[model samples]
Target: MFEDIIGKMRGDFDIKPMEVMNLQPLVLAYIGDAVYETYIRTMLVVNKKTNVNTLHKMSVNYVKAKAQSDIVRRIMDKLNPDEQDVVRRGRNAKSVTVPKHAEITDYRYSTGFEALIGYLYLINQTDRLLEILRLSVEA
Candidate 1:
């Protein structure tokens, strides 16, 4: 389970939520990936009353790098400067993993999107996170 994964990620540090900014962008993206995946799965099941297999298929459209890249581009101008900086850092950060089907630009933007989500989740900024998520849907 993700709890076990998270426990491993903790390593030897006692990281507080507010201190997430000090972490590597890739690390933020790691946790953000989990957060985003759970968000999409939960939303789909709640709104559509779908079965697991159907929900899994539907969620792929929204969770893939290409879709996240598009969503990030659409919502970028809405972000404040601080948030934009976080995205910029994430976009520029080098990651070892790359999606075979996505363009480089799309993958970078998706990383940026995940980084933003990660930062907010780390800080417990649920309202702001949800607002951005809703805006992404409108896009």
Candidate 2:
């Protein structure tokens, strides 16, 4: 399934096995940021049919650090040991910059949430990813 997507969208990015295995928390968050934003944008376009400004506002509500942290708090109990570990890893990662508007705790938790998404994506656990994302979005 993913292979087809990769083949069709053969862009400049390439994921080497070693990199995936030894990925840093920051790197995971980086990838997760893009993935989560893409999901938000796609969902809004498909379901809301709103203008760009409205879509951006809605997307901001869902994608902000505080929002992501709330989603993680709601869904943490549903995650398994490995997923929890990924979240913890991301939460503990050290970042140089801080979010201008969000609290530090919220930012950390949001990073953790992103790390979980990135980890699941690297493992090609699409069903699990979708399930978690659906639950989070609905919450």
Candidate 3:
């Protein structure tokens, strides 16, 4: 289902899937941020319907930079070497600016976490992606 959606999106845009290894770390983080937020929102909505404002506030607990950084810290030891390398590449990637609300360290680490999520998604590793996402929620 995930692959189908990604493929359809690519087809719609007439864009070929880029080689994951050759893609910039920030690019991965970009998609990862969206995917992570979507997952959290979906999880929340599926559990129970709520006011949009309430849902947004609840989702923030999981999707915020500090929360993501904490989640990554808890699960880092469980990642394979390749996943760790992806995180490192993402964390070290230079960006033009940081969000005003996040600490620098939290922002960097959250970027790394998002990159790992994006890497797994791009590679079509659904099981591992879901595993990590589940762990993130638990964390």
Query: Which candidate comes out best when scored by lDDT?
Result: 3
- The C-alpha TM-scores of every prediction are 0.85, 0.87, 0.87
| Order by TM-score, highest first | 3, 2, 1
Candidate 2 lDDT, 1-139, residue by residue in tens: 4334523443345666456648998888887787778777878888998799999999999999999999998999999998898899999999999899999999999999999888776666667877777887894
Q: Tens-digit lDDT track for model 1 on 1-139?
A: 4334433444445558657888898888888888788777767877888688899999999889999999999999999997898899899999888779999999999999999988877766666877776776663
Clashing pairs in 2: none
In model 3, where do residues sit more than 4 Å from their true spots?
Answer: 1-18
In candidate 2, position 27 carries an lDDT of 86
User: Candidate 3 on 1-139: residue-level lDDT in tens?
Assistant: 5445544443453223457867899988998898788778888998869899999999999988899989888999999999998899988999899789999999999999999988877776667887898899983
- Clashing pairs for model 1 are none
Model 1 scores worst on lDDT over the 10 consecutive residues at 1-10
Report lDDT (Cα) of residue 83, candidate 1: 87
Root-mean-square deviation of candidate 3: 2.8
